[model samples]
Target: MKEVYITKISKFLPNRPISNDEMEDKLGIINGKASKGRRIVLRNNQIKTRYYALDDDGNVTHNNAQLAKEAIEQLFDENFTSSDIDLLSCGTSSPDQILPSHAAMVHGFLKCDNVEINSPSGACCSGMNALKFGFLSVKSGQTNNAIASGSERISSWMKGHIFENEIKHLQALEDNPILAFNKDFLRWMLSDGAGAFLLENEPNGETPLRIEWMEGYSYAHELEACMYAGGDKLENGFLKPWSEYKTSDWSEKSLFAIKQDVKLLSANILKKGVDSLKRALTKHDLKPSEIDYYLPHISSHFFKDKLYQEMVDNGVEIPWENWFMNLSKVGNVGSASIFLMLEELAHSGKLKKGQKILLSVPESSRFSYAYALLTVC
Candidate 1:
């Protein structure tokens, strides 16, 4: 098998940065009332600014596929174009449509020649899955070059009108007048963006990051859903999928809105993540001292200290100085977050040859985790 190198990295963060004060303006007030949980979520997430694909009028400016397409365009130059790509792998929790896969839609927009395409669906780990697929394809000599992307266009779903039906239903039942915290909180937490990575058999740029290895693990068998959309969780810990619900029940129950069991996430997310990291390190015979940079995909600053303590408890401590994170500036772009962080660090000019970088992503959807080791060459 051959080696795979990440020759280029790029990101598209949609329109201008939206500050905490401007978030509700972009996403709009739900049920014509301000959110009570917005400030708390923003404070915990510590996201100072983020981008959205919507204009001031709450109209979508770019769909999910377009965001991925724009990011992919940044990878091309006079030497390489879309036609040079042998495989396209895209991952997104919020695709523009349900029928056509995200990669298929992106390919239609690129207008490039036919090539192998893959669309991996999930939460944050979806992006890492796409990256892994591209890596294995190139390493196995199935393709000479590949483009992997992670993107989300969830702003449209978070708009105020999307929840009007649910608000009315709750009011009719004399239930809680506001949207549930599980669904309302996410409106302030997530933003829109896309990021892409160019992989090849040989390094193309002046400083290439070689993919040493990638590892992933899931605890779904032992855990129930922690974060979800297009469904509701039952008392028995089963997720009643959207397909089982009637059309009217969809909006009435806000089944499409992103929801999180905060208690469940707080309990297992970090512990499971650190456990997976330990296993990956053991499998690869690596040590914390060998890592020069640590890029962790944390959804909020709330988990920053907790994650550190978890690592310390597990005896795999990577000091704070070695960490690199852009969650404050970019918000949680979901699956695209890891790619966006890599794009920033790869172009930051701080990397040196032979320095090792570790990437970690934890998906609370079902307590899944992914880790990767890269070396600057």
Candidate 2:
């Protein structure tokens, strides 16, 4: 097998950064009432600024495909062009349309040569899945080069108008006037962005990140869904998909709104992550002490310390100094998060040759997790 190297990393954040105070103005208030959970959620997430594809008037300036296209474009140069791409893979949780795969839409916008394309669907792990696909393609000599991307245009989904119907329906039933914490909290926790990586058999750029190993695990067989959308959770924890619901109930129930089972997430997220990390470490015969940098995709500041304690308890602790995170600045871009974090670190001019970087991504959707080890060369 040929060695695969990440040649380049790029990211595209739509519009200007919207500060915390400006979020409500951009997303609007559901039923003309401020969200009681917004401030608390923001406080926990610690995201001070985030981007949106929407303009000042709440008009969409760029869709998910456009964002992915822009990020991929940054990977091209005088030596490499879109025509040189052998494969294109994209991953996202918020797609512009459901019928055409996200990669297909991105390819249409790219207008590149006829090439193989792949779209991996999931929550946060989707982006890492795309990267793993590209890595394997290049490593196995199936493709000379591959472009993988992760993006999200979730601001539009979180807009107040999308939940107005649900709020009215609930009010008419004499239930809570506002959305449940599960649905409403995410409005402030997520933002819009896209990130892409160029993978090739040969190294390029000043400091190439060689793919050492990648592994992923899903506990869905033993765990129920912790985060979901496009459906409702039944009493027994089974998800009723959008196809099973009537069209009228879609809006009335806010079936499309992203929701999370916070209690389940908090209880199992770190535990499962540590369990998966332990297995990966054992499989690769690696030690946490050997890692020079650890990039973890955490949705909130609330998990930073907890994750550390969990790792310590599991006897796989990587000290705080070895950690690198940008969540407080970029917000949570879901599937695009790990890509964005890696993009920043890759361009930060801080890496040294032979240093090892560990990437960790956990998806609360169904308690899935992905981990990758890279060596700076």
Model 1, runs deviating above 4 Å = none
Clashing residue pairs in candidate 2 (N, C-alpha, C atoms within 3 angstroms): none
Candidate 1 C-alpha lDDT tens digits along 36-65: 999999889999999999887777899999
- lDDT (Cα, tens digit) per residue for candidate 2, span 121-200: 99899999999999999999999999999999999899999998988898899998788899998999999999999999
Assess every candidate by TM-score. 0.99, 0.99
User: How accurate locally is residue 312 in candidate 1, as Cα lDDT from 0 to 100?
Assistant: 97
Model 2: lDDT to the true structure = 0.94
C-alpha lDDT values of all predictions: 0.94, 0.94
Which pairs of residues have clashing backbones in candidate 1? none
